[model samples]
Target: MAYTGETIDVDATLQRLNKAASERGFDCFSLVEQDGTVVPYFTRAAKTESAPRIYLLAGMHGDEPASPLSVLDLLENDLLGMGVDWTIFPMLNPAGFRINQRENHQGVDLNREYKAPTTKEVKAHVEVIEQSEPWDLALIIHEDWESEGYYLYDLPTELTDGWAPRIIEAVSRVCPIDLSDSIDEMSAKGGIIAPRLEDIDTEPKLMGHWPEPIFMHAEGKIRGTYTFESPSSFDFTTRIQAHNAAILASVELLLGSKR
Candidate 1:
């Protein structure tokens, strides 16, 4: 599952995001530096304070270039519809991307550190989560090096039904959904893996660390969490498009629900 694909331009990508976010009236800033790479956060309020708020995150794994690229594509093109608040972490692991590894230079996987964060990056991210309002939805972008195609991990509340199915339909337009019976060694039905809450807390595979989605569930940080996984072995364009399609679909669904 070693990702031997393209590596993103950390500096260039972030630069583009900063501009795009600013033009869209977003407030942007950075709070952490990992391995000499600055980590930035961008947030834009909804058309009204009562509108749904979406928290969008990408690029926690350095090898997942399409995660950040997908975010950049959406932001630059302004494809993300209006009326919903946006909180974005375009690239959480720039150092990892700079080195083309899953973890940062210190050998820390930022995703797992969210349960009990030790690294400054995760620590800062935890603060951001705690201080923010409960988001209507949080989309965590990722790519799977071993995946046959696109798949997703759904951690939805009682109210989050109907979204996963809609997301699948949207992704199907761009790439093949990995309909495997098992994904990431977890039971999957229709390209969706809904890990049991008990398993997340007790699973041996996690080694007692919380992925960002897990931490969100445990802390009640967001109402709905969908972690999109694109196939890294596939063509880069498809991977990027798949992630883009997934995210835009989520945004569209959220806005439509409010109407």
Candidate 2:
């Protein structure tokens, strides 16, 4: 399926994803079903028990087409073959993706529904996390329509202290980095927003609508999480390439830390 800057065909995308998973020996499963639309997840285990368990998630916001597209690109190119236990949620909001909307069909933002999980999708995702082994790292791909270049939110941890910089450098090769001193109302340096855990804790409204990374941290599901934001204003190909580069760089960093 060639992506030619046209509206996405969600069914075709899922077909390609399933085919890639089958050919690559990844185990695929249905994560959840919402209004007859089933969201799928794929997993590939590492050869060694001590290997890091890494999670890759995309398509939380349907308007960010590049997020899921990048995951598909990586799967097709075998970029996810690195020796790490992998669990990938390729497209979480299929209902919203169908119409190119940020929110789901019910007008709920899936990304912000992780706290209470009022939506079926968030509930299902939370259940999977609770029933599975803890993840060492999670890489979430997203897009900001308001941004001019790539920027990321890194949950500050010893493992992620300098990791975002490396990711930014890698993505810069494919897309420009957001040089703004402030991004998303948070202080950012070198296109990276490394927020302290306590700082995140003080946000009053965060209790009601928690983003996925925050939910993962709050539940002790992952030690580190990086939310990569590609500029939606860029061309589709450039945005996809930028996301793919960041994901690969993040995986390399996590794997190196395990070694």
Candidate 3:
């Protein structure tokens, strides 16, 4: 089946990526739901024996088309060709993708349900991260409809040195940043930006509840995990460019800065 218009053909997209990996000799796998919707994942084997592991994910929210599409674009374009143990979970909510909804078919927000493991989608993502083990950095891509700017949520780690600053600066280069030091300032933007985990209320109904993957960083599970939100107001082509630039900047900041 072909993915007509701007919509993605999930199966064909996965096949394309896997075919690319096979042709280029990169490792690849699919994360699937109980109903058999194939979720694409790829692991690029390191060129050298010593390259470290890096994890990247997008589309935890089904409605956020930019992140998932961007993820596919990067994979299709061979962004992980560099020698590294790269694990990319391209999309988690295909049903949500189909309807352009934020939650899955069960109407659960996969992002908030991570702590409780109430949804299959969230569980699958968590399982992948746990199995991957130690990672130098984890980059999660996301998008917001009412966002007035772009920002990052980072936790403390050794990778925090130059890479952290670069991530912040590079995003600010193309979008306005909401730099809030206090909860009041953070909340001023209508909940588009993620507050520090400590500042977030875990109330079930609140968007901040249970916190997003940024909170997972403080748990010592992953050293540094960050989420980038691209505003949907931008034209599709411009949004795609912004999304791709962010991916390139992130990979270069973590992998290139290490060299």
- The clash numbers for all candidates, in the given order, read 0, 0, 0
lDDT score, candidate 2: 0.87
Q: Write the per-residue lDDT of candidate 1 for residues 117-229, one digit (tens) a residue.
A: 89999999999889888888999999999989899988857657778988989999989999999998899989999888777767987757889988887788788889999
For candidate 1, which ten residues in a row score worst on lDDT? 154-163
Candidate 3 Cα errors over 4 Å, as ranges: 1-15, 162-165, 171-197, 200-212, 215-219
Best by lDDT: 1
TM-score of candidate 1 versus the correct structure, residues matched by position = 0.97
> Candidate 1: global Cα-lDDT?
0.88
Give the worst 10-residue stretch by lDDT in candidate 3.
183-192
Give the distance in Å from residue 31's predicted Cα in candidate 2 to where it truly belongs. 0.9
Q: Model 3 over residues 1-259: C-alpha lDDT tens digits?
A: 1112245565665566567655656666767763467776777768787776777888777667778777667766766657677777777777777666778878887787655676766677777766656677777887766655565555445665545556656666666554544322344332133345554455335444454464456445566666677766655565555667766777777667568
lDDT winner between 2 and 3, please give it: 2
Give the winner by TM-score. 1
Candidate order, TM-score descending: 1, 2, 3
lDDT of each: 0.88, 0.87, 0.64
Q: Comparing candidate 2 with candidate 3, which one achieves the higher TM-score?
A: 2
